[model samples]
Target: MHTHGTETPVNAPSAEIPMTAHKTQAPTTDRSAELFEQAREVLAGGVSRNTLLRAPHPIYAERASGCRIVDVDGVERIDFANNMAALIHGHSHPAVTAAVTAQLEHGTAYTMATRAEIDYALQLRRRAPGFEKMRFMNSGTEAVMAAMKASRAYTGRHKIAKVEGTYHGGYDYAEVSQAPAPHNWGPAERPASVPLAKGTPESVLQEVVVLPYNDPEAAVAVLNEHRGEIACVVLDLMPHRLGLIPAKDAYVVALRDWTREDGALLVLDEVITFRTEVGGMQTRYGVSPDLTAMGKVIGGGLPVGALAGRAEVMEVFSAGAGGPRLPQSGTFSANPLTITAGAAAMKLYDAEAVARMNRLGTLARARIEEAIAVAGAPASVTGAGSMFRIHMKAEAPTDYRSSYPSAEEKALLSHFVDGLYDHGVMAIHTGAGALSTPMDEAVIDQLADAVLASLRKL
Candidate 1:
């Protein structure tokens, strides 16, 4: 196997997260605040992503290597967030950097296709049997939107069904019922299709059917109500927003059977869950989806998304046989830089690498559970493979509604996240984290230790 030669030490002394009593005090962020002030004048909301927003000001990253990130404030923290689970090998993997730098000498984007695109596609298709044919996009949202369109084109249906509170992306139909509250989220059997963005067209809402997560019977019953009108059922095997619990095998099989019977497509959004296994989380289900939307770690920390699945379904994007039903093309689609970096990163994440990372995930989750018990905190952990989430509830939540945080729980979680930040650990604000290939048991222990300290303080 090839190696990322002479890589920077991931376990350097600087990577150690301080567990000092000073954790209660806020770190100095004068420089970050200054940058935010300047950013406010130009960048809306003082940041490019709403996810980057913090209470005072978002900390500005100076540089990152391996599992550690240094901020403009001269503070170094362990980066468990990993760019929202997009950095499988962690920031600036030597191989990815070297490959991308080499690609830069050749060129960047081009109107013509490169061998890099074909090579990367081949690599991905080999990894996941379900990815028979694929087309690249710029982000997960675009891939999902394209997949939904392909489903409609192939099935000749008008509506799409998705699990409630499962975040696919920013597309209009995709975002429906992503975060409906108790009052708005109607009956459990058939969830109401609530709009995420303000003034999302009623027509878009009408075309989306929301199904309850995990409960296979209820979900299938809802799909049955829709009958042949549904084009696809969008799913995230383990939705992070829904508390990072893997979907029950029964639920997946139910969707697979339902879609097969209804002549609708099963679109698995593995953009996040793809890291869970060499062939993605779907491989464990003993079934295959008609379409799969992939992104995140596949980009090698850059921007990329891909729609891959049965060639029959993906043929909707083809233009050769006849005028394509869904013409898909982007200026930056399959650009050389992303393709080269992704290929480098993925090549390094072999089956052994995946197993090691997942073992670290299991260790991290176990340690966090031990910490919860030691602190006597009413918290539970749920996750599979290389990711985990800490819930404030006494038991791990079974579904979105069950996991939905109450006002007190939400406030506590916010404070807990701030506490984790103060303790030199950066996790997704939801108390969730995805392990990177660069991490080991030592790093997992430090992360769990931070969780313990934060929970004790609370």
Candidate 2:
């Protein structure tokens, strides 16, 4: 087993590759560049989301099958990112495609409820018993927004407490402190709620109580300090943006205890980590939250999100409820197509499949750690289940402050990721990867080899 350290590892003679010698040169993205140029004429910044912007340009995906995605250039690569860890079953799974096709035969959307929606909801409840009642939305951002609104209605409080450096969604309140720089990030014990976007109003920032992650005592103290004002404490068990660091069990326990004591709701944001287990990451921590926001894998590669929780708390969304009812509606909420695809995908992600994928992830992590040790690189892998992210540091980061990479480290990581792509492996520029149902031991080994080659190149 590889040991972690704070200082950079001493490079072995064989690993002493010059940084400039192996620096990744920009790829020939002729088609993608042309498309981007055309898109810029109409689309802002030539992309819909900032995340889609790559070094030269984003690769236009032509088609995907199993664990492979083919770009417009006709280059096929193993998909390790899997659409930001959303495609647990991988691209174009027969079950999901067939289900969606069948649903498409019937009308795509309807004002009335559909059988597929009810069926999918039932399946979700079975997997996550904490979801006594739930509502679907178009995306994770919407789900988180709904969760916060429900918490406010139930507790009659406007303020929300969230962990610093964790990403809940794009919603103004949830996005606070997602990427606080060292200068702006206050003390580790009590983090300041820094706005992620420029136009964010001071009022929105003030409503968020930022707490340090992994430090149970500090988080608990912050929660207690804002006891009466906070309606909910939103957190992701394994936040992707925070180097995929799993929340400490003690920290989670503290959150549960403090929220209960303070009459504040605990909301688990499992948008990316829901695939960690059949019962979700909450089951792994053995802590239940009042509400849970879910997305990614549950959507079956479709745009979907869900807010679920205790029946009493969720009753705020009910129409026949006596008190104030929190109205929730969306034209595409729980549409039949997404419902069918999601249900089919969920059915395939049985305990056996989940275990298989997680086992592959473990093997991949072990191999990557071995590569890091062999290359004597200042890097380590952090994550659980089928999700993993490589950090440009010797030690696994405990919190967001420690996780922040220096300019050199960031450049090196970007180059390394580009190398991986060139070697026929697709990973997020930030060095995150996710396993799919189609991945086996051999595929895991291949990915490990790709990581090794990429590290050596860097």
Candidate 3:
């Protein structure tokens, strides 16, 4: 129910990606870069995921437990990225590992539904706003894709709307619609639907329409224009990728109202925002979206995703004429292992747990702000609950446009993130988001000092 008292407006999402080869910081890369070259000969890009393949070479993690990750070089650093905000309880939590181990004894996957999966869905339904039933998947991408398909089938519409700068996943539909860079994405406002990676035909991109994040007027206008053709308007509750910018209350309220008037499903993607609370960001914002996309913490450091919302919309999976007609099949969807691990993780995440983490986050942010102020750096932190991002700019952005950095600014931010590692503090290369539970006041204080020092050097 609390709103950020500050009246600062946010910027929109946008960045001019480079055509040149990705840069590297060899001096700072350490042995990780050397090992990456060996990895590249066999493993394309020396990494499994395109995002993981950073400049120079990615650090090969040898061990991770709780708040720390040890690279192959035997260097330990505090993990603020937490696997892109997935590790809500942090790495190697005893409960999660034990649950997974126990599930392994029973079986990892059976292709049939498991009791744990049903229980997990029930668990989420209990917390989600207006949640009726749910389905499971192996990743946020699958969850998002299913939601889109269900919307399309339910409404008999082919077009879908998305917020700019939101990265859903690597599926053909998702990547082409949202993922930026190397994809030859067209103009900023009205981008040409471009596939991020290979294999996605130009055909898929034609179905997606990109909209400005945190701009309700644009959304209203576009929806009016696309009315009969649009199935759903999928977007992050917060403009997370554009330096973790948050949408305004006015905009959220506006979109919710407009969607109701237009008879289109409102798909709220909470994959990253799930860390905010036990009930998810929808609970925090009090928005009852038609369908909700979920992932990250729900997997308990494993891989899982889910879609849940009002029964009227979610029932598209049930059996009946014009009733639950979409098909959602994932081999590992709702596997017992991930469900058990996820349930175990969620068990420990109560309101008190959220409070503790938020306190630590608030402490860390306050200290870092103090340091920024002292150094007089044009930097700021923004986000809600236990998640936040470090962005270097004079003002706090209101949307993606104001939030995104120029190409030079991003390079500088990446360099700064690498510098944080040099100072024994590790952050996501994107300069967005941190995790909780493994971290405490002491760890937060340590990171605050390190972040302050890093900013001072800049």
Writing each residue's lDDT as its tens digit, candidate 1 over 52-95 gives: 88878888998887788878767777889999999998877777
For all the candidates, what are their Cα RMSDs to the real structure? 4.4, 7.4, 8.2
Model 2 clash tally, residue pairs? 0
When sorted by lDDT, best at the front, the candidate numbers are 1, 2, 3
Q: By TM-score, is 1 or 3 better?
A: 1
lDDT of 2 by residue, 355-428 (tens): 77787788788988988888888899998999889988889887788889999999998988988887778997
Model 2 scores what on Cα lDDT? 0.85
Best by lDDT: 1
Candidate 3 deviant stretches above 4 angstroms: 1-31, 176-202, 321-324
Which is the winner by TM-score between candidate 1 and candidate 2?
Answer: 1
Clashes of 3: 15
User: Which prediction has the highest TM-score against the true structure?
Assistant: 1
Candidate 3 structure, TM-score to reference: 0.88
Clashing residue pairs in candidate 2 are none
What's model 1's lDDT at 39?
98
Residue 248 lDDT (model 1): 87
